[model samples]
Target: MTFKLDPKMTLGYVQLRVQSLENQKAFYKLLGFTIIQESATEIIFGSGSTTPVLILTAEEDVVPRPSRTTGLFHFAILVPSREDLAHVIGNLLEIGAPISGAGDHLYSEAFYLSDSEGNGIEIYRDLPRNEWQVELDGQVNTATEPIDFQGIMALYNPERAWIGFPTGTILGHIHLNVTNLDDAISHFYLEAVGLDLMTNFMDSAFFMSAGGYHHHIAANIWQGVGAPLPPKIATGLMSFSLILSSTDELNKLKQNLLAQNVSFSEVEGDLFVKDLNNNDMIFYTQA
Candidate 1:
């Protein structure tokens, strides 16, 4: 069934746990995110906007988990422009931070990094929507190519350095490691959620999104099948929540799930479900 989705609607933000408040604060600052609010144990970072992208709370003597576990693969931060990305990349190089990887994903260019505490971070800039190539079936196609590091470096104007992320930028997407890709695709794509399938990799990986964008959610078994979920003691993803444009859309999603016999719970009027990897997800409607 075809439905209309609002492009302005997207992932709101992410709330994460951290072992040390000071270290998390300093780490985020290096990425150009400004501290908007803070308390003794909690600090919120964003682009100086009302909507925060990253929220970190200090925990007492907690241990973090390896990325292989079933938890947040990475939190994507969307930059306003390529120059903005270059500014952050230049700063990271100056500080000697080890980069995990970099790639040009046709629709966007991205650099990957990890914080001192092992939380994954993706700094990326999206190509204009009109520049994206769409297939005959209305599917968006993205190619993996070598990122132009030198070309990006040329835009690294010190005077135009990014002070903070741009407003309206958001979490963008969340990737998960699951035991069974086909099961996950069926549960999230065909049942519980209303996302359209973007691409699938034959029982190994799958990507889905709303409004025809590349992907807001993706799952893969590259880590390993039957891997244990991340322990609650770790500093990592708290949960993922999707905000629908209106109550009608929310009801439609609920009805669709019900018709497909998907199981979910209701928490404070929000539909709650877990992915095949046991990652928590909440779906609620906005006025």
Candidate 2:
């Protein structure tokens, strides 16, 4: 009953609809993401590689998503080291950015912030892989506790001016707000798109990952039970990419979707499927 994914599976670029291009550029630039591609209507940003990690598309007169909506909860950026994480917090402090929350999640230490359009963001570094504790039921134990801010800051070198995201940074995970956990679990995650269950908290939230990492995806009804989908014109998540290691693996998932009778669209060489909540998950293989 192991619900694992291909070892090479990874999260890729996240596309978002933003109210102001300049605002997003300024925010992401300060965080060390460089513009890799740009157009009149869209801009692609990368952490330290040419591959796009975050994409922003222009949305005119976009409405802000309501709190009680089923959509993006947050997109997490995982840096290579604790020192890199400190650099993120340091830069935020220097820019006077408003942080919504900062916590030590047992397995990782993270700081939460939001883009100008209110899309949630988490910048974090994981603890050593060996230190993760798993329970009898095979769920990783994660707790929300205060981060050692002082300790993290002490690692920051004042000699080095704060710059943007480092080379090894990656789009670590995407967490979503869903109306029904059961539907999300069975209809979308397990049956159609395969992802290993990592943890579950009460009946409210659960975490899933591909290759033994804490979580590559998470869903929660934290907004409200049976929350409605945000309007299309709302400034929020558009879609996110899941990079599979090989075309064969991608085909297996495509077959799984077909068997479940899930509607999907194929573009070029990739496939894209929508979850029960209508959130788009794009599957593509790298060369």
Candidate 3:
């Protein structure tokens, strides 16, 4: 934990493999994302920029992820305001999307859903930083209480048309299903990646982040206990990016990774490595 992560760094994008391309594309369209790039095998979507927030690649007849697999649990997309979150809910209601759960963490309000491939997705809005709760140790505390549905609905402006994610919409955070929380914490995240610990949930889940703005990454063994990595063609998470703020930070991480002899690949000048479960994580700095 000696390497101080740059608080400004955030998740870049998430890549998922799907069984059906058109079906997943249709689902994302309903959630208000525009296609930025498309091909026969893959499609990339984003709110406004050429930089994609979500990437879906078609993998036909691949083995579906098992219930207790160690892979993606969910990836969250953070909107700018509560009203934006309301807009997302309103749209989901119109499409009859199956909402899994809704929670008001002390720091944010989030609604969850599952895609056709059973990949979890969360759309949420963060409360202002000034409103967040900080513990005595400079870490944050979060509670999974029920959201105020009435108040959230009140913020929805039926007068305004719901556009795709606003210009500021971002790929916020990612939660993963791992086999061992201790290994993830000691071997990967805290010791090598150098993230700040935020909170621990029942000794089953650990939330960590670069800044104190809540969790940028979380790992849990809720379903996948002592599981192994999914097959290469598994229909779930393909890869994700852990972006760095500067080349110096990226180089420091590279050095740490080398010290541990973690095998990583350099793709187009960016570094990519795999976690213990073999999930690919690319590291790079934004221009």
Candidate 4:
């Protein structure tokens, strides 16, 4: 693709329309997020910032995401260090939270879980860049191996109480389940959306990134080919923000979409676009 997003660009808030705001808030409270703001039917929360990174809204008629739908696979939360990761693992264990799985990816270690409403979540810490395995072509070498649960837990001082996600905790990336791999890649590629190809996993998934990071966005066909999108009022991902370092990067993205003949709408200072799966993407400058 002809366009490359600025390396400094990263993900911002992930908004979800849920069926029960009270239940979701109670669940996130266990994960260390402080309520930044709340209303009768919505809540915004983050680890240590006034700028919330997660938003949950309850709509009266919202339904659960239907089967075989193109929507969120997971949203990864990047912790600052391996030790911090261990702390989160420990917290979950202590609270009897259901852990979906865990893995060692060579470049990073991560574990997965689901929220009360079935939204997937990942908690992970990256290996130092110097330690990451990268090919001469700049594609990251990713591996799926069993993580050392014993070793990670060893780093945990059960002596310390669960506080929550650390100050540096941020929304690292978001993964989606699309209807078709080829069509999704066409919409998500470097030239199309300003990301460089980082890795293509086993022909089933594509990982793309900006600024040489492993991935800021990933999509897969693991659910099925030609999966249908959920209803507009489904309880899952509503939209997510991609935060550019400056307005210049946002403008460049606008130009890239125009070149592709893709339709996008700008509201206030933010640009809104939809992917092949009908997932909403908000492109904007950093807060």
Best by TM-score: 4
User: How many angstroms is residue 263 displaced in model 3 relative to the true structure, after the best TM-score fit?
Assistant: 2.5
Q: Give the TM-score of candidate 1.
A: 0.86
Q: In model 3, what are the clashing residue pairs, if there are any?
A: none
Best by lDDT: 4
Of candidate 4, the 10-residue stretch with the lowest lDDT total is 183-192
Candidate 4, superposed: residue stretches over 4 Å from native: none
Q: What is each predicted model's overall lDDT from 0 to 1?
A: 0.75, 0.85, 0.85, 0.87
Checking candidate 4 for backbone clashes, the offending pairs are 1-191, 2-191, 5-194, 7-211, 32-164
Which 10-residue window of candidate 1 scores lowest in summed lDDT? 1-10
Model 1 CA deviation exceeding 4 Å by range: 2-8, 59-61, 201-203, 263-269, 285-287
How many pairs of residues in model 1 come into backbone collision? 0
TM-score of 3: 0.95
Model 2, range 1-287, lDDT digits (tens) per residue?
Answer: 43345768999999998888888888888767899989878999998788899999997778888779988999999999999888878877878887889999989999999888789999999999888888877789888999999999998876676557877999999999988887646667865677777888777888988877789989999998888998888888889999999988888888777777878999998898886557678899987
Query: What TM-score, over all chains together, does every model reach?
Result: 0.86, 0.95, 0.95, 0.96
- RMSD to the true structure for each prediction, in A, is 2.7, 1.6, 1.5, 1.4
Report, for all candidates in order, the number of backbone clashes: 0, 2, 0, 5
Kindly list the per-residue Cα lDDT of model 4 for residues 1-287, writing each as its tens digit.
Answer: 46778789878889988998888999888777889999998899897567778999888889999978889999999999988999988988888988989999998899999998889999999999999899999899898899999999999988776678877899999999988877546665656787887988898888888988999898888889888888989989988888899998889888888997788999998999987767688989866
